[model samples]
Target: MGRPVVHFEITGRDGQALRSFYTRLFDWQIDADNPMGYGMVAREGNTTEDGVGIGGGIAGMPEGEGGGYVTFYVSVPDVEATLTQVESLGGSRALGPEKISDDLVIGQFRDPEGNLIGVIQAMSQSA
Candidate 1:
């Protein structure tokens, strides 16, 4: 089966301003209580009882990164292997199959046309 697009992120220069704009524009409720202050809008916050929409995060660019971009993450089985396949398919690694936590590994790559994309993998407990 093909991988599924799971999560998304919108990063900009001013996270609070972006969060305010989006919340006002869409009547969304964002929670930015995390250490990074990344505003996260849960899927249930936007989705219907039947589950219609994907969850996403809004945040500022890392310190000194002046610009921003929106990217969606595709769920994969093995992030490192997927990155290798991405390179083989003309896509170059942009970030990493880095472990964000014990359970989550994420990576980013630029497609042949230089469009950035993200991939995520759920680490197996047995690993």
Candidate 2:
């Protein structure tokens, strides 16, 4: 794992609209609905910095939920291991350390005060 968040999912409504707005506003070339509605937000393949990664996505909500809020994913070597550390460090798990792809793993968790955070690692380094 590279201890980086190369991809991010922008959870919200009107995926196309949000994609369009960002594309025009920031001139971001977003490939929305690329696969299974997992739209990609990036600038070419240059989504990495040094060794860190940066990426985002867009998805729908259940009519009434937390939308339009961008979540921050911190770099970590292993989501499962990191979650264990988080729990031991006075944090709690809010979501799974699920594998979104062979190269990506995401797990939502919260701090002692209920502030959400995430952990991600690349597949290449995962081996």
Candidate 3:
């Protein structure tokens, strides 16, 4: 099966401004108490019970970074193996193979063309 684009993030110099803009433009519900100045966005009137929507976040840009960009996360079967493949294909790791939870691991990389992308591995029940 092909990897699926599962999530996205937008980073900006001003987290609150970005959040306000998006909330006004898209009517998204944003969580305000996130510790890292990140806001989680929920689509307005979304009815999916399985969390199937293309949910995303808005956050302050990395310190000293010149600008911000949007990043999409692709779901993969194995983060380490996929990162190896990414390297062999001339891509480079940008962030992690960090474990986010018991079931989820995520990583970010820069493609050959210098675009940032993310990969996620959600462990199966039997894993």
Candidate 4:
């Protein structure tokens, strides 16, 4: 089977303004109360197997730091292996197979033409 694109992100230098804009523009329910101030768009009933769409986040970078970009994350079985394959295919590693938590690992790469992409490996509980 093919890998699934599970999440997306839209980030810029001003996260608060971005969040507010998206909220008014799309009527999206976003929660950004955490320490990272990453606005997680509410999935509603969309997180279940019967759900209709994917979830995503909106974040802001500190001044002169965050470059504005939009990217989606593909769910793979192994972050390291996928990134290796990506490199073999002429892409280059941009970030991790870095573990974000006990159950999540993520990475990024730039394609041959320099399009940034993200990959993620989510460990199942049974693992």
Question: Which candidate gets the maximum TM-score versus the true structure?
Answer: 1
How does candidate 2 score on lDDT?
0.71
How do the residues 12-69 of candidate 3 rate in per-residue lDDT, one tens digit apiece?
8888899999889977887868567679875545436875577777888878986788
The per-model lDDT (C-alpha) reads 0.91, 0.71, 0.83, 0.88
Residue pairs in clash, model 4: none
All candidates: CA RMSD (Å) = 1.6, 3.6, 3.0, 2.6
Deviation (Å) of 95 in candidate 2: 1.5
Candidate 3: list runs displaced more than 4 Å. Answer: 43-52
Predictions ranked by TM-score, top down? 1, 4, 3, 2
Candidate with the greatest lDDT versus the true structure:
1
Tens digit of lDDT per residue, candidate 4, span 1-127?
Answer: 8888989989998899999999999888889999889999866744657777888999997678757889999988888988999999999999997988899999999999998899988888224
lDDT of 2 by residue, 1-127 (tens): 4454455656676767777777788666677545566567663553446645466665655567766556778777778988988899999998778998878887888899887777776666565
Candidate numbers sorted by lDDT from highest down: 1, 4, 3, 2
Q: In model 3, which range of ten residues has the least summed lDDT? A: 42-51
> Where does candidate 4 have its weakest 10-residue lDDT segment?
42-51
- Cand. 3 Cα-lDDT: 0.83
Which scores higher on TM-score, 2 or 3?
3
Q: Rate residue 57 of model 2 by lDDT.
A: 67
The TM-score measured for candidate 1 stands at 0.93
